[model samples]
Target: MMIHAMSASALSQMDQPAFVAALDGIFEHSPWVAGRAWPQRPFASREALLDSLVDTLRSAPRSDQLALIRAHPELAGKRAMHGALSAASIREQLGAGLLACMPEEFALIRDFNTAYKAKFGFPFVIAMSGLWRGDIIAAMARRLAHEPEVEFAEALAQIARIAALRLAERVAD
Candidate 1:
């Protein structure tokens, strides 16, 4: 495992591009999150560093926020099946047992993914840690019924959880 053994102070001292690179894969395909939060440096602790990153997400414009949400691949979607997921995403999904789905399980999640994207206009975003395929499918089914606004908020919240997990995995206090 590639663990980033830097403290908050070390990370705060890095240049913007370097900072972004260090945290590149933490926010799905959106390195801009770290790019934007670079100004809020001099973090007091690991928790504060994570807070600044997530705060960037919370305060972003609707379009940018939607872009971040859209940037995440669907759970057990085509990307996972094709072995094309990013390293962080692959690790998380593999831990969730998503990388080895059975044919029937794949078909089931494919249907859920199709319905989810059709309904929400973005892929379903979940922090797949400690979750099972059945749990994911149940979440997809339940989230499919959420109103657009509700589901949108839920997606952002889920993405926040993912970021926290990624940061914890890589960076130390």
Candidate 2:
């Protein structure tokens, strides 16, 4: 079903099943985000709604966060076998090809991934939107130097930002 336009009040009046179904449909392309539960009551405004979504994402259990991180494939190599990522994510992965143009950057990403996983037991996480390949590699390299606790917190924060953006788009205007 397509949701062209929906007011907040109209959306709130929907039954539980219908509301979940609508959210599922809108967010199906990004199941990691879809798997999260919505607030019990309607949010008063877009900002309030986004804030809640961000909070949920930030406070998600470590297992959930690790699952989300593992769901993402290495940025510059093969595409993920999973079918649920958004088009934006796919494009970002593809765009990482630019890293290949610079051998040092490519090597840096590889090394950083290794060190990051060794330090934190998970892949490095970053929101690839609005970032170029060089910028991402640079950020990865920098983040590689962070303490495990600091990196974990930073990764969670970036994930929240990404979730907030996705939630904002799915929310009825």
Give the number of the best model, judged by TM-score. Answer: 1
What C-alpha lDDT, on a 0 to 100 scale, does residue 67 get in candidate 1?
Answer: 93
Candidate 1 wrong stretches, greater than 4 Å: none
Clashing pairs in 1: none
By summed lDDT, which 10 consecutive residues of candidate 1 come out lowest? 1-10
Q: Residues 1-173, candidate 1, lDDT per residue (tens digit)?
A: 43877788899999999999999888989999999999999888889999999999999999999999998888888787788899989888898888788989888889999988898899999988888978988898899999999999999999999998889877886
- Residue 119 Cα positional deviation in candidate 2, in Å, after optimal superposition: 2.2
RMSD of 2: 4.2
Q: In candidate 2, residue 18 scores what lDDT?
A: 62
lDDT of 2 by residue, 1-173 (tens): 12234445655667656655555423223344433545445767656655655556566787776676665556553343344445656655656554344667666677777777888787777776677877887888888889888987887777666555554555665
